[model samples]
Target: MNAARTQTDRTTARSPRPRAVLAALAAAQFTVMLATSIVNVALPQIRDGVGLSDGATTWVVNAYGLAFGALLLAGGRVGDLLGRRRVLVAGLALFALASLAAGAATSPAALIAARALQGLGAAAIAPAALALVMESFPAGPARGRALGVWGAVSGAGGAGGVLLGGALTEAWGWPWIFHSVALATAGVLVAVVVCVPRPPGGRDEGPAGRFDLLGTTTVTLALTGLVWGLTTARGAGWTDPRVLGALGASVLLLLAFVVIERRRPDALIPPRLFRTGRVAAGNVLMALLGSVWIALFFFLPLYQQQVLGSGPLATGAGQLPFAAANMLGSSLAPLVARRIGARATVTGALLTEAAGLLWLSRMSADGSYLVDVLGPSVLVGLGLSVAFVQLTAFAVDGVPGKDTGLAGGLVNTTRQVGGAIGLAALTTLAGSVTAASAHEPLREALTAGYRSAFSASAAVLAAAALLALFLTRAGAPPAVPPAAPAPRPLTPEPSRAP
Candidate 1:
């Protein structure tokens, strides 16, 4: 019995702890998110240091997002084929190196290039990390809880990025932001290497098919064109020749991609995946929600700084309430979903967010943060966080194990693409409204523009809530179809002495 007990202790010591694995995965997720927003506060300093032109300065932010969004599908497919853990480690290493390069860059072009490389790494990390989470926890209460934790960390990362960016930019300097990310990411990478187990099967285990090169190229380029066009439209106007040309090329390329996907057996995004109503509806609603989510972060900071005369640090600090509420809501999502079901929970959350946006639309030119920002921010935070958790679950609910990475990528892609389009359109609308109100004081005109954007966002969320009612069934998620055979156990085969 003592020998047996000793044997058990050795076995346990050799195994990876589940909580440690989750923590490592969550840290990777947080690092990816932090890279996205951390640069916003440091842009001015970076611009000054790099001697960036106005156009180049914009690209500093856009470059990261564009690469991240465009390459997600390809990245996910690569993970599915190459092995998630292998891909994850590779991505983290690349991200860390890119961050280091970004921090040490002296030229505008070098910084932008490094940022894009960072995005490429993030595209690999996000989907692989999420897919690993789903794989780690089986479907049911455990999965739901894991997802809640995932959502909470994601929300916190965004807010933390801004706060950290402000503090670091003030205390250490702009480059520290990237250096800090590099340090944190390197730490996460080591934790992952230590804590996460290898894939159940060998690293090469995946669906038996060749990569769809043509389909991938077309879709990636199409997404790139679309995102670039939208981003260009912000400064160049929708009717500009360049914008029109890019949009036209994207539309054509997208059509070509659809045709190629239909013909190819090993398509990047299998058409069959969308046969389930939940997958389609979930992505749609997520897109809408993402529009508001990204827009809120962008415009809220601008309002605080421009209209309320708040400094960057104060603006970052003010988001604390929203961040706290977001984390709380994410934590509670599983419990709420268990009681009311995911569909109902999603609808309710959308309505709550809409209500908050509507309230925020009434902000005055001379309004204080207490009366105008805090209450609405709490509501929006709670609602957005809960909705995101539910929608994410919905998007991948019945997906096959073989395509889990693809589903993760798909959901992320929609959110990023929607955010780009929404931000551009709303920015344009706000500019137009502000121009129309030029007769008023500058502050009042700016407030009017912001109010209009908020009102429009509220309407969009309300529409999304109504759509959620129709798109999903009344009960629990539909059952998953028979998937490909599960991978072998993580234990390695015994080796014979030579």
Candidate 2:
């Protein structure tokens, strides 16, 4: 009895507390997302402080995104192979160091380089953290609830970054944004070390195979080229030879990646994974969702600050209603999914968001926040939160345990890539519309441009809603097959005869 009691104590000690694990993972996810948007409000100050030109100012944001998106696949795979805890710890260390470097930098080059490094760390952190969440929770109400929390934090991070950035920049200048992230990241790292448990058999117990170096290289370069080309097009125009060349090279590299994945036994992304229809369809919908989501954050702030003449603090504060609504929707998503099914929930959410965007597109130059922004913001926030949760569930729904990291990486990659492309395209369109309306008042012209982008985003979301209808049927069961009935024993027949 003493031995058995001792063994139970040992098992209990070894097992990680679920709440602690969830908190650590969620904190990690929030930090990575915070890095993405925290700098937007501080960009002008950063540009002046670091002597950045207009072009260089833009790179301060794009550099992080490009690196993050490009390396996510490799980062996720590395976590899966090398150990999630190990990769997560390393990523947190790197992210902290990079944030310090960024904060201390006096030159544009140093700052940009540090931001890129931060992105690399973020790439590793996001997927590993998400995979750990999946690993920790079994599928059912528990996982659904966990994912709802994930979705809430993820959505909150975007808005929260803006709110925090504005406050930090206002109180202690722009460098404090980086400094704050570093400090928070260090705390999260410590929590992860204490709370997160290693897998059985040790930290290195992954599939035994050579790393797919060729596939990794090809895909990374391809994503880099694609993002670079799109980012350049926003400022340099699509016809620029540099942009054209980058796009062309990216296409070729992507084709090569496809070929390499098919031929290689240890591919970065197995071709067979696409055979799962949900995976493919889910990613497509996620891309469309991302296109609108990213642009919404970008344009909303500009509209508040530039068109409405709001200060940075006020602009950030204005997003509270939206953020609150988003959190509420995220918390409610699982309950709604249980009632209506994930597919139908996603479809309804998309349509709801589209309606909100359509309403936003009708904003006037002389509009008030309550009339023009608040109501629509609530609608969009609710819809966006729910759609994000359902779509995330769809993407990783039937993936194998070993490839959970890969699945996380793929979903993240599509969203980031789609955001980049959509931002560039929408920015260009808005710029053109604004220029064409030169005869109007400056505020009016700007409003028109913003309105156009909102309308376009609404159309995109509508299309996604339509696509969701065909992709997954309502009330469809999980991909797991039903268990077979047990066989009857021969002795049972003799007993019946007797």
Candidate 3:
């Protein structure tokens, strides 16, 4: 009782500024998200240092991705179970330590392991931080402003990572990429500890129940198999024994996961949420949009580096337009969403994205960045910015406040998992396209591959827009917009009494 009361005191005290917690949360989000791009600029050096083949080195990036994306949902649930602040701090600390391990690693295996650890930490931190923001701010203009700042920083983090990675790689070698993450994230972690308040209802981590351990196991194995199948489809035919067996195993495991969720007292993926159109639609779109995004980052760099003969740093720089546009669009999204309604905003955004993707597909041996890149960027930027901001609001509409964190998790998980699948498929398709152009010079072939991939990506984004249209309920009066997301999970919230 005493402990519970003390926690209650912390929630009600009002001593620390709420905006301070918001500030801390935003910075933490930016720092951790930088992990998404910090490795891109160092791909060459790390490839050389670790003696990794092209396919294998992809894992150095995907290891963190696989871990972070797979575990995001479970991480969100964990935050709801433990105190959010405690989890955030611990995640930051673990992330920093993992960075240190990655930086000093001497072997390929060590580096891969460290990267996985970093993902694990990120899984914990990302959701917890979002939950913190949701809890810290009320759901209105204040939350909107906070989310806008969060979104801009989120976009900027990618640009920052690219620039920083290039600088570090040039000045201090590949290990410096890892070292920079460690040093920067640690500082943010300290600030978070000092500022963010504990949950209001005390250690509000509800009673510990038996987690869906079986469901978790099956899902993990299933995704691992799927990724494996996708990864080696180039070397090993899709019909090859290894590939077929893994994919077949994945289906079986996923089926088992569904059965497990149905029987468990506490399910891993609660089916009840899917009954709501907003939750279900948001999740599906998140997955598909993620695919669009991963495809762009994967191919855009190749376009600049392999085709244009730009170096790694220059390749990173080429992405600046998208990043900057994403920032501008995100910053302005709430206003747009408020005016048009979240659903309409999402639709418009999707159309914009489709237009951009179609234009982007025209890349050639000598493509026009000014014509091809700039115009498409406007569409991509406006579409993504609008869609992301609005889809987030759509995710929580009519959801009971208590389910906010889970709601957040569902959407975020779709994005992470979809990205994994998208990357695998797009890379495979690009390889086939490039191989078919064997008569062309190596650079020419590579450019052909990027063009094909970019076109396909645009189609997917168009599909996502169409998907968003049917997923949301039509004709409902627009409610006030909710705060958006950058990281993978939900924020805490006050109850929504009718």
The prediction achieving the highest TM-score against the true structure is 2
**Order by TM-score, highest first:** 2, 1, 3
Candidates' TM-scores? 0.93, 0.94, 0.89
For model 3, the run of ten residues with the poorest summed lDDT: 489-498
lDDT of 1 by residue, 1-498 (tens): 999779656755676776787889999999988887887767788899889988789898899999999999888888877777888899999999999999999998899999999999999999988888777766666667778888888888888888888889888999999999999999999998888777433343545567789999999999999999998998899999999999999999999998998899889999867755377888999999988887888788778878998876887888889889989999888888887767789999999999999999999999989989999999998999899888888888777777778888899999999999888888898889999999999999999999999999999999999999888874445322222234323232221110
Top lDDT model: 2
- Candidate 2 lands at a TM-score of 0.94
On lDDT, the stronger of 2 and 3 is 2
Error of 3 at 166 (Å): 2.0
**lDDT by residue for model 2 over 295-381, one digit each (tens)?**
998899889888888777777888888889889999898888887767778999999999999999999899988889999999999
Candidate 1: RMSD to truth: 4.7
TM-score, prediction 1: 0.93
Give the Å error, residue 222, model 2: 0.4
Q: For model 2, what is the C-alpha lDDT against the true structure?
A: 0.86
